[model samples]
Target chain A: MPIHEKSLIRPENIIRHESMNLQGVDVSGDWSTFIGSRTITDYNEDMQDEIAALPGGEYIHRCWQCGSCTNTCTVNAIEARFNPRYWIYLIRIGLEEELLRDKDILWQCVSCNKCTYTCPRDVVPEGVMKATAHWLELKGHTPDSPSTIFDREFSNQIFATGKVEEGRVLRRFFASTGQALRQPWLESMVIGLVSRLPVKMLLRLGLSAVLRPKTRKWSKSRAAITDYLQQQGRAERRALHLSAGEGTHV
Target chain B: MTHKEPTGDYNGFGPGWKATGLTPAEARRATDWVEAKIDRRALLVNKDRVEDIRERMWELEKDGEIVVHRIGDQHEPVVARTLYGWEKKIPTNSLWHHKSCGQCGNIPGYPSSILWLMNKFGIRYLDETDQTSCTAWNYHGSGIGNVVSLAAIFLRNFHQAYVSAQAQGLPVGTYYPLVHCGTSFGNYKEMRIYLMHSAELREQVRKILGKLGRLVDGKLLIPEEIVHYSEWLHVMRHRIREHQVVDCGNLRATIHPACHVYKMVPEDVIYDDTVMDGNRVAVSTGLMQTLGAQVIDYSTWYDCCGFGFRHIIGEREFTRSFAIDRKIKVAVDEARSDVMIGHDTGCITTLDKNQWIGRAVDKVYELPVMADCQFAALACGAHPYKLAQLHWHASPFETLLEKLGIDWQQAKAEFESYLKDVADGRFETLYDPKRAITSGPGFVRQQGDQAA
Candidate 1:
């Protein structure tokens, strides 16, 4: 947590004392040339193998690192580090280190899928970005992000009840985010007031978030679903390695 | 054999009633009439769809359905008791009304309805200046405007709202929480969350916003609660339900929640699909249920009402195709609901007003269209249904009301009184179109002239 003056000197660190033209030109000349030159060698080939294993993995090999995906990205316009162009370039070259550096950038995407929709050859750049980001988190190279939170708690909700319980998801989300215990008084007050309201009244106030009753038939299905996902993940990892081997020979 | 004679409130009692010797025009009027009479049947037949889905969504409801944490079902008890009644803390002093131009071009009174409701609740709000349209429609449609531009607009409006609220001694974002065009609210939330997700987007938006003014210390300018006017009405349904003091009697209304509001955040939509529970959420369906109307679930329940940004401006047919498949055909042939009640102005206009265009092109759907508020207002005895602005669709769903014995004369009186109270500065506009018009590149060119 200690601040180091030298930390400001990194290649990606472009100090902006004032606003600069964002039309691909830097009036401050602070645009990092190094962002383009960063080596693709830091990446492990296994990362590409892993990404080619997702639902929409066919589009992975289709990208040739054209900046069109990045240039068209609405997220990239604001968060430069969250560049699809750079992420795709890393995946293309297997630069695992650089990919991991900006893994948090993936969460910033609204999943509007605009990039995928506009892609020339229908390459799903968004999915590829997500696949690589997920891989980084699985390897412990990335920190917790919103998508991870949603995926974790949502999965837990479904995993436990075989269906999502809204009240549980929210409660877990709040507690996991450290907002639950920290705001104990607020929580208590909410509980007290909500408890006093009529059930019908609560539903009308958009409190359906907390009022969903449980599905009675889901208890037995949870074990089967969990087993299926685990088995699927192992099978996918094997298939990815085989595909990567084929790519190397080609 | 036909079971209860199709409830004669809608124009065409039920299926195949079109063959009943009524002329095509007469049949259209009959369909309208039949739609008016279904509310009486709801108390006996309607159930919340969420409860049904919750009961059946076995896989989706269980915790530990995945390999992550095996937190057992600890949240079910909390989720079962839906909360509706909240102490009325209406802020009428100063409200920073953010606007939407798309709603303005289509249905003008959506904002007016919000204002009317605000006055009814005696909540003080500010309809002030120096605030602009979130410009969300133009930006999202063009796919050119980035988070910076969006956040700048959000900050400017929130900043003005914050300052005004503080001037009145209220918390910054508390009193003036955003009440926007349906899509605008969804877009704002999406953009804000996305920006916050990346420190980079947050910093960039902050830099741009800083030029306008500081976000204020110790007070975040983000809206504390983003309220949709329909949701507000849904919350106050208990008080307003009794005022149905007007009798829709048996009007059959199919509630349409805007896709952007629910689809943009599916996790937030609490209503069910399999079950018919309409009173479980602050959504269109819930409000319709509260008004004592019958809500039918036709197939294609989740399809977009098809006012896709490009379709509305460039390709009219494409837009109609979405609307036809999603609303018109389903409302008539499948659900057999008489009228489609909409919560968003855009959806209302597309479903209600645009039907005539679809009809002229031989893509006709004979359903009366009105907003949930307009419908609620009608049920409350307010009429002429001022919110019945069908941009390209025909009007006079009067036949539907007539079938239910609702006097249009009463509706006209209620609507006129509502507008009168609004013009008297007694209400605050929740979804203002003129205000939305002020968001884009200065002037709205109305499809032909160059914008200034």
Candidate 2:
């Protein structure tokens, strides 16, 4: 019997989502802030080499903007505007603002690394896209991205406790991200229930959380970090003063 | 009629958590069953098992017993390493670089730090150029860009690198290789494969090249090799080891190879144990082992860092969900490692940068994430003090430093001293051309843009 097209394809593979929801989070700042800044041309030394060292740096220069990288991308299948070809073009053009404007798109990459996996030239587009996003963050524009909330709260908690206290990290993240707290009584009930779970489950979780390891205090890990930051800060300050761009007191 | 009449009292909905009358034991059993299924599925797809199976197949193929075929309709078997020999024989100089968008924000220091290290090695390189991001992120996430567009950008960059090299008195027809982010390295390799097989693509690229006079003397500008930094670093390992400019002392580290780099090119992976290695690849892991860090084995060492294309974009729940479950959760809850190290930038960002968020959502795991370099730097004593990135982390490296009884300040100073020493030639050069040439395998012939 002739196979039905529907039968030939898995029902689950059907694409049905409206797609907008899958797009990147919207940036809040004016696009103009990034447009004129020399940040686009101001590549960190070895930025090029770093890209070259990436999975497919060799073929990145081979792009002709045919959009196949985007056409074949699974992410674009879910969201139309999130085009990889356009971003590549933007980076190639040194349009720092355009790249930064789409910070959400960069983070939205699921990193299946499929584009690079599928890229004809071995461009490893995902890494390039990722590096661009990193550059944007250094410029101080955090995406209204949920992921950032977790990073910030986690860092803040770790800084305070010298170890990650999950319970504290969760509570702080909820508060910091403007997520409404679970009603006190509701939370209490949940905690009570959790406490009542099998001894093994609770024991495992509790042990893992408490045994959170700490860096040796004598290692002066903290001081080393501060010094590096200070040195980097000073260098950045000097660079800014020399370049005559707006400067911050590092 | 009697049954119907009795049912008249019942609500339309199923049991409202009361009628099933499940005992606590029953409830717990049901929960356990569900959790078991979850664990089972995770195990089956356990990234570790996947790597194991793939590695076994690789060994079989290497022994000429069987040939591995490419996935699905792709007629070609995935190309393993033809470039490794070339990379070993001739070192790369003056390359065109592409960037990764995601890592640009999260781990801002990866590229910068790598570049700084390269310069410290006295490697001649160029960073300035109008190079573009490979745009793989958007393409992978949005599916808007097509192969033709990608090839166009590929051609443009190659054209630029070739011209730059020519101007510098390098051979005019030479292929100036590119270093990349994410899957750019793999994608380029694939693109070359596609071009070799497709007359249409080759012709198209040729026409484009012709317009720009890129076909110097009607020959392709062959790039030397597409090298991943992990492999590049591995190549320099002996030298780095010999220099011994800094001491990392003692620390425990777990290495996470980028899925694109390791899983995609399983055979070519220099440290094949993890990708092809059982729980870990000895070479990559051995680098750390030799550094004197305790390496721990975990169940899900080979799982994707949740940077999978679909997970990162449309199915963030799955993306975030899996990342937490696979890497972050396993590292902290299972492996109990102090610092989770990765090879590539994207993995470093997702696994290293995303660990905190994973913990916040599920209150169990919180492991400090770092790249292999950062972790190695820690070991080499190059990173004397706890890095701010680590200090600001929930499981800061400071605690580890403290445990080691290290003077963070002195370490930091020493690390700085090493950097200066490296810059000032206080450290000896490890690459001896004569020894490398005599060892084995000279550089592979440059494969210019085959299509053009």
Candidate 3:
């Protein structure tokens, strides 16, 4: 008889013959199936340590595989493959090749923090997911995602002026992400507001767009933050065994 | 099929028959037991095992490592209980308005409603433009920023709040910070814990703050409590209800509690036994109940509004889908809510702005979304167009207004005539605009700028 829960085994690792004879008994295809030995040799042993070097990845080692994060994950409900628990397990075991399979959707973490909130062991799975996504981009596994582009656009404004004007951020983000400013839903939303908003409010919004809101005497704070982030970026690159100035834009 | 012969007690079943499977009734009981185990109240009770970071903050304060921006008698604080029954003193007066960038830029009504309500109560506040956005939205959306950057921003903004009163000839700490954005509320709380725990982090931010001259007595200034505007509305709900003119007893309201407000620092969020039996965070719900509105419950109360900082910008389809399906649809279909109330800037924007797009996919659930303060302001007889600024909202609030016995057409005409005054530069403001430029280049010293 076939082994119970045989589906758990990888189909690629299960060998089946069309027909076979076991001694005197003519055991057909059903009885001729055999389980193949499974072995892993391409483990990137430094995967866990490299991820741990990132900001959010610090507590990844604390995950005890209780699967609570995946169970309560917001993204997991929408996309079942966006599993934080499974990814953390793959990361902890140094299965870099296995992790690469889900690289595209890793950055899709909504940061709802439901995973971090429910994590029994305080693994902070949300942070781990972010670190892994960052690791992917740094190692050239993928290019900068649209989310990264938006974050950079938003953060650059704060680092420069200590405040963000939403209009400026939205326009710049759409531009950097190579998306048009004129999406159907976006146009409808703007029209809906414009139809009712007072002219003064509209003009004020227009004025803000012209002269972006900024914190006064923000030069010192901006300089300090730039210096700190650059230093942190250099340190993170070194931890990942990359040369200085690699992925500098990130 | 062959029928099994009846046995003594087993009835043809093997040993441990009870363990093999559950009957329908037994299965239901098991499901209920599991549900009860994971209920929010049970989860909150289990949270007691975690160390309270506030205890450590007090230790650090006593050790002279940090300065606590206390809620003094002047601020008139009201004590409230949190998830784990922790005491949090919410100041009811003399508040420093830490405005939200998203609210001001996206939904003008949000902050206006807040300021308008405070005016009705004659609450002392400083509506200034000196503070910066918490920048947590950027950090959470992108993996670029570290904890150090967030900590420095937190201290810088709170330091401004601490000393902002000095500009008005009042003593320092006169105005305790009242955070306007839910994201800022959550981010500041988390940053406070991080700053207290890591001496190294505090040292790093202290240097940055020192350079900016934001340090108080050469030490970082930390607030005793990070209070959200919703909490302020919650504590003052009864007083606000006394001024209520519109009867919302017929309104069915569903609250979209910001995840950042309660979930981030779950222990710090208010939970009253009177509100939803304390099973849910009580800020928005408490106010709605106090206003005599029927606060309805829905299944997806705990889900995020999909304002996933990145999801809203980069993967908008996911945001729209989640907002429409999980939030708006559930509130409309399950609760038949007249309106969806939210406390966070992003939640309001996402839920309100995304509803119009739902029609593209034939999923048109036209539910109006507004901040709790805006709704409260409307109930208290604030002009829907002038004061509450409902015109700035994307969702169709006309139906909601009509149902509440408000004349949108008259309000619109009045606002249109008011706009002519605005166009000619005759504008009305909640506070003196000169006070907005506290320390900026355009700052003009008031005549009575002397310490009282």
Candidate 4:
């Protein structure tokens, strides 16, 4: 019941024979080869619609599979899997299982809009990629991306005060994203800057940090914008099938 | 929307009626000038609004009695009437200066350079504290800001410009709304189109602003057209060259036309290849060409510097990689550029800061990246370290300055000693970097060789 000599080797393209006598020739260099096949079973059919429901993703249906977006993508040249065309195909056909394989890298779209500029059909693949990233977080597939955290803090300052003070935004962004304030590159940039800046200018910059930059008489406009954004948030949530008040205050 | 005179009611005056001293005739004239200044096609919803407005502007010019300055295309050469019987689109009188958060915060040299050139040209500009940052950065970066808030801010800044001009006894449109940032220039253009295109958006914004006491004569006042400061530099390029104090003879300049300036509204972007004997393409390129620089064209001229808003702060990896791979690498390897002129702050910062990391990582290519105004300041003989502030930028320009026959080391040491004197209170507190040096370049060259 056992081929005794052949059992010594692992069946990974190996051939073994204790004794071989054939009528013509012993012609077995490779035998016992192992092959594997895969089947995709977890297709979530509503994937495209969910991404499209987010802002910047409404034009996903316009892609023509020309691969222009991927070819022109600034990130794609450096990374192999950051292909917008492949993801759009996986998305359009509801290959949710396949899409999840690239989950860790989906939010890395740099938003250069080169893809958007090159897309003949106006697919706006940069926007689609952003929306896709937003969808991933909303659906609990990934945690808040560093980009999301940075954008949230930046937007918050603008909402509170009609202007964004650069120093304030940088500090808050670094804090929220768990990054050190004294990053080597950032410190180097500041050192170069302050080395040449006059003392009066330094005093002025320090004053802006203490006083903070803002628009005059921004109360009414700020209140209106807050209401409008809240309404937009509720609507976005409704489309995603989540509770209206599920997330933290944006 | 029809252009009808305000018959008997004066209801059209809205909140503007509160201005105490104006008689009926004076008010009517002001209203007519305001209405006449507007590009009617800008207010109308249409597929071909830009060209349509241009065509209609010609028709109005033919029929009307006032020999008015055409509101848009102020940067084009044809507006100057072939150099005689002209209006200075680049204003020589005092104009209000709108500050940019990005310019003032990230690249302090940008504003200072413009001020230096203005002093050189005898052009007067006012930096007003009553103005505010345009706030377009947040709106475009994240979609958190609604149309209403942006509209309110736009109205607020332009209204301040108009009111200040009037207080100085100049017309409402006299100061010309010189936008300092490319993003604000483009964002305001987009908002203008949106405000004209959607009645619902406009009414919502109007109501919101009216409550905040921003409605002028009960109407949102839109500027004739937004003019970027880079455009002003382009218009005066010839004057700058003929009067140039320093010769940038051996330099080659390549321009990175900030995407926000060229790509946002492609049709409205100034200059064409055919405009200057198949040479001029953008304001930066045009101005550089006029300065006798050997301007080079590279393959990645159209690529963004990867400022990508949040990508700079959050995705530092992509920002740095793209800055080197897409932009600086092409400029250095392909064009062999001496200096790169970028119009926007983010693009300049992205290019200027990331080159150090590029060298650190063994990706070794180099070029000094700076604002177009900074280059203009340098060419007009502003002090390299003090006024041009090359010491603050990451991309070193000492080699380029040495090529221009200016002593970079001496400039640095002199400025350093100046700082020490100020620290010791041995010199005057008010230091002016743009004060002209009496010695010629040859004399400076001799002094530089001796110092070295």
Q: Which residue pairs come into collision in candidate 3?
A: none
Instruction: Please give, for residues A1-250, the per-residue lDDT of candidate 4 as tens digits.
Output: 1323444433542323334433343423221111111345467778888788888989998888999999999999999989999999999888986787788899999999999999999999999999888887887778888888888888888888889889988898899888899999989999999999999999999999999999889889899999998897887777777796564436
Write down the lDDT of every candidate, Cα atoms only. 0.58, 0.52, 0.86, 0.71
lDDT of prediction 1: 0.58
* Winner of 2 and 4 under lDDT: 4
lDDT per residue (tens digit) for residues B1-452 in model 2: 34322333453322332344567699799878866754332334324222223344455446553222212211111222221211122234443345555555666555554554555566655443445666566566678866655665665555555554443345532333435464776665455445444558766766776775656445333333445655555555555565454444456567676777766644344433233333344334655665556777777777888777644554444445466666676677777777677766666666654544343333345566766555544443444332323433334455566655556766667667766887888763323323111111442223351222
Ranked by TM-score, top first: 3, 4, 1, 2
The docking category that best describes candidate 1 is incorrect
| Candidate with more favorable, higher TM-score: 1 or 2 | 1
Scanning candidate 1 chain B in windows of ten residues, the lowest lDDT window is B68-77
Model 4 achieves a DockQ score of 0.01
Candidate 4 lDDT over B1-452, as tens digits, reads 87545444553334334444567799899879966875342334233323322233344335441122324332232222111111224443454567677777778888888877877766655565666767777876766777777877887777666555443444555554578888888877677667655667778877876786656666666664556778777777777787676677689888888888877754456653423543334587778877778888898888889788766644455567678878888899899999999888888988998776553345667699899888888888878877878877887788889888788888889999988987888664112322112122312222222221
Q: Over the stretch A96-209, how does candidate 1's per-residue lDDT look in tens digits?
A: 676667766665766668789778867798787666655555555666665667678988777776677665677787777766544778778889999899988877656555
Q: Which candidate achieves the best TM-score against the true structure?
A: 3
Q: Candidate 1 — which residues are off by over 4 angstroms? A: A1-250, B1-96, B166-174, B218-220, B270-282, B385-393, B409-452
- How far is B117's C-alpha from truth in model 1 (Å)? 2.4
Residue B264 of candidate 3: its Cα lDDT?
92
Model 2 residue B421 lDDT score: 83
